[model samples]
Target: MTVALPSILLVLLFALNLPVAFAIAISALSFFFLADGLPLDIFFQKMVAATESYPLLAVPFFVLAGSLMNAAGITRRLLHLADALVGHLTGALAQACTVLATLLGGLTASSSADAAMLSKLFGPEMLRRGYSAAFAAAITSSAAIITALIPPGIGLIIYGYLADVSVGRLFLAGVVPGLLLAGSLFLTTWWIARRRGYRPTRPHFAGWGEVGRAAKEAVWALLIPVFIILGLRYGIFTTTEAGAITVLITLLIGALVYRELSWAKLPGVLRETVLDTSSVMLLICAASAFGFYLAWERLPPAMASWMVGLTRDPQMLLLLINVLLIVLGTAVEGTAALIILTPIFVPVILQFGIDPVQFGIVLVTNLTIAGITPPVGQMMFISCAVLRVPMEVYTVEILPFLAAMTAVLLLITFLPGLSLWLPDLVMGP
Candidate 1:
């Protein structure tokens, strides 16, 4: 009966539409109080144990760094560069939106943040340029999903910690999949823009001179992943340290390099970072307690046995897991899904010889894709808010983008080599 407390509270909180972090915490608290066999002190112990992790240090640093980058005007410069590069192509504005999102996603870990920033910057312009408001909203929301598959991705970080995989490797594994998704969205945008007759903003290609100028402006912002991977691989720092370094570097770039960081802006950055980090950290703390409860209830073992009984073949198991993840992604927050499912699925995936880092990519991709979906999709809501478009309108317009994303997800799911090769090559074994 004590073991059941966590699950019961989980259901009750979820039904009440409580925040994911609070739900997990409340459930864990219920278990602590209701379980006669278990001591309440264990909950406190587990909470300490959960946060004592060395790798977990990366969470705050990365969040802070991402916030700093946004403040530094890296996102704005990157968007300008992306616009210059893609604005001459077919469906120029639409493709530019995708390109800019991909670039910004690399710098920022939050999809909602990316969506809000991009939509605010480009939404009105898209409408004025003859793109439908719904289409603009759809593109903004869909493009932001790529953020979760890029390095420094919060979703991937949470997944790595939950699944007990190396967060560094997960960061590297995300590279190929992120590019694939970006490319697919680019093509989809082109096709749709052609059909819609969206006009190009630029008349011709920007020469190397212009490209170099743009790259120069964005160079500091672009080196973030390079620094993180190198630092992690060479033992210069752990993932957590890398995240802290990212924040420091981003601040330097914003204040010293870009000359944009001001005293006034500092307060806002701190405030926003505090809010963002608080939300994510709470989720982690709650997940810690809930994870213990899951083990107490023998959920992982039961799930493993059930999965194995359903299908012993690795390919079939992968397929089933992918389908389930995709479905869950639509309804649950990506971070929540990662926390809950990572513990349950890691053992089963390892049993089938699936690469944990590769699976992390697949999992994050599916969840990000779901952000464009209807009903509970946060990205959908953010995009709509930015563009002031109705949900019904954006849903119809976003189908092509969704199809493209699904294709990318399937590719990553079936072809592990695509995700693994880059990590193995760069990180080496």
Candidate 2:
């Protein structure tokens, strides 16, 4: 009754369109008042404690760095580079959109932001080139899922933080899977473009000179991910320190190298960062209180035990988890789901001898896929709105891309080495 009441209230609040943070906070607070001997002060303490962690500082720093990079015109250079590299292919604009999203994934780490940017930048261009608005909106929104699987992904950071796993390893582990996703989306777009006889954006392949110039222009932005990985690997900085360092590097590049970010624009970028950070951190705070309630009731271990009883095999257990996460991802906000569910699932997976790092990648990837799904998909709505496409059209066009994403999810789920190889090679298991 105690658990059911809060769970039901959460669903009701979500249906009522309440903010996820308040829904969680309100539902969680109900537990203290309803349950005997539970003190209200503990709930307040839990929310405060959640934001007090040194590692949690990475959230705001990375969010600010991403905003600064975009405001400084890094995204334009990246788009140009993506076009130079892939703009001659069949469905050239679509291909470039995928590639650009992959690159921006390393920079922005927000799938919705990537989707919104691509929709505005390439959406109309694709339409002008005879591509359907649905196709453009679908690819733009779906490909942004790549951002959540790449290094410095916000989802990866939050999952790592909640699961008590190594954030560095999580970042290292995401590289191959992220690329695989990009490639899958690229191939899917190519197949569709070829079948439909869609014209290429460029009349000819980019010359070496053009490629070199594009690369040179985007080199500073390209180095951000490499710098972060190297910094983490060589003990130059902790994960939190890396976020701070990234902000410093981005500010320098924006002000001096690119010379695009002006003093007047700085305030706007900071405001965007604060807004993004506040939404995310507030969810974290609420989830912390809710998690405390769940812990008090011993729900995590109980759920783990129930799940373990269903299957002893690690593979089967993971498959079940994938199913659950996919459903939850479609319905719940990914960050809230990550914070609330990680506690319950971590113990279950550990008992099956699954690596937390590998599981973290899989978890983040699955939830990110949901960001483009229907009904409540934030990215879906963003793309549809920016492209002025109907939801039904966008949903239909997204089917194949969704299939591709699902395939990648299954591949990562079953192949531990795919997620673990780079991390193990670099960090040593």
Candidate 3:
């Protein structure tokens, strides 16, 4: 009754449109009060302890770095480079948007931020070029999914912290899969554009000199991710330190090199960072309390045993897990889902001899796809709001991109090498 009551309260609260963090925290508190002899003091301890993590510091640093990059005009430079590189392809603007998302994925970790930025940056132009609002929204929302798989990804950092996996290795492990997803999205965009006869943004291929010029302009912004990977691989810094270093570097580039991030802009960037960090940390605190309840009740082991009995084969187990994640993802916010479910799923996957790193990528990717899906998809809502497109229109247009991403997810799930190859080569197992 103790377990069922809390779970039911969580669902009921969610249905009533309460904030996720509050819902989780309230439900968890109920567990303490309802459970016979369970102490309430432990709840306070868990919530406080959850916010005291060093590794978790990466979230705010990375988020602030991204905000600084925006203030510094780094994103504009990268978009120009993406345009010079892929602006002649079919659905040229769409292709460049996807490329831009892939590149920014390294710099920024938030999918919704990427979607909102891209929608504003390219959504109007795509519409002016005769592209449907639905198509524009679909492409922008779906392309942002790439951000979740790329290095310095907030999702990867959180998963690494929660699952006891290596953040540096998870960063390296994401490279191939991230690029592969970009390629898949690129092809899907091209095929759809070709079929619909959507005109390319550029009349001709950009000259090499033009591409070179754009690259030169964006070189400092481009080097951010390169420096992060090298720094982590060579032991120059720990993951938390990497985030701090990234912010320092971005501030330098913005203030000194780009000359766009002014002293006046610094306060706003810090304010935004505080807000983003607070929201994430609060959710983490709430989830920690709920996770504590689950641990106290010994739910993970029971769930793991049940899963093992249901499927002894690793492949089948992975497939089943993916389906559940996708469904849950469609309903829950990705970060909330990650925090609440990782404890439950990690134990089961380990019993099947699954690599936690690979599972982390698969888990992050599946939830990312859900962010663009229907009903409760945050990315979908952001894109639709930006483009002024209806929900039904956005849902229909996102299907192909969704399928393409799903294909990549299945490939990563079945072929562990895709996720592990870079990590093994760079850091070893």
lDDT winner among the candidates?
A: 3
Cα lDDT of model 3 by residue, 183-215, tens digit: 999999999999988887788999899999999
- After superposition, candidate 1 runs with Cα above 4 Å error: 1-12, 44-49
lDDT of each: 0.83, 0.89, 0.91
Better of 1 and 3 by lDDT: 3
Q: How badly does each model clash, as a count of residue pairs?
A: 1, 0, 0
Give the clashing pairs for model 2.
none
Give the TM-scores of the predictions, in the order they appear: 0.95, 0.98, 0.98
Candidate 2 vs. true structure, TM-score: 0.98
- Least accurate 10 contiguous residues by lDDT in model 1: 1-10
Per-residue lDDT of model 2, residues 1-429, tens digit only: 766788789989888878889999999999888889878999899999999988888888888888998899999999899999888899999999998998888888778778888899999988888999999999999888888878899889898889899999999999999999999998899999999988777888898899899999999989999999989988999989999999999999999999998999988988988888899999999999999888888998998899888999999999999999888877887777888899889999999999999999989888888888876788898999998888888888999999998999999999999999999999898
Clashing pairs in 1: 58-240
Which regions of candidate 2 are displaced past 4 Å? none
lDDT of 1 at 253: 85
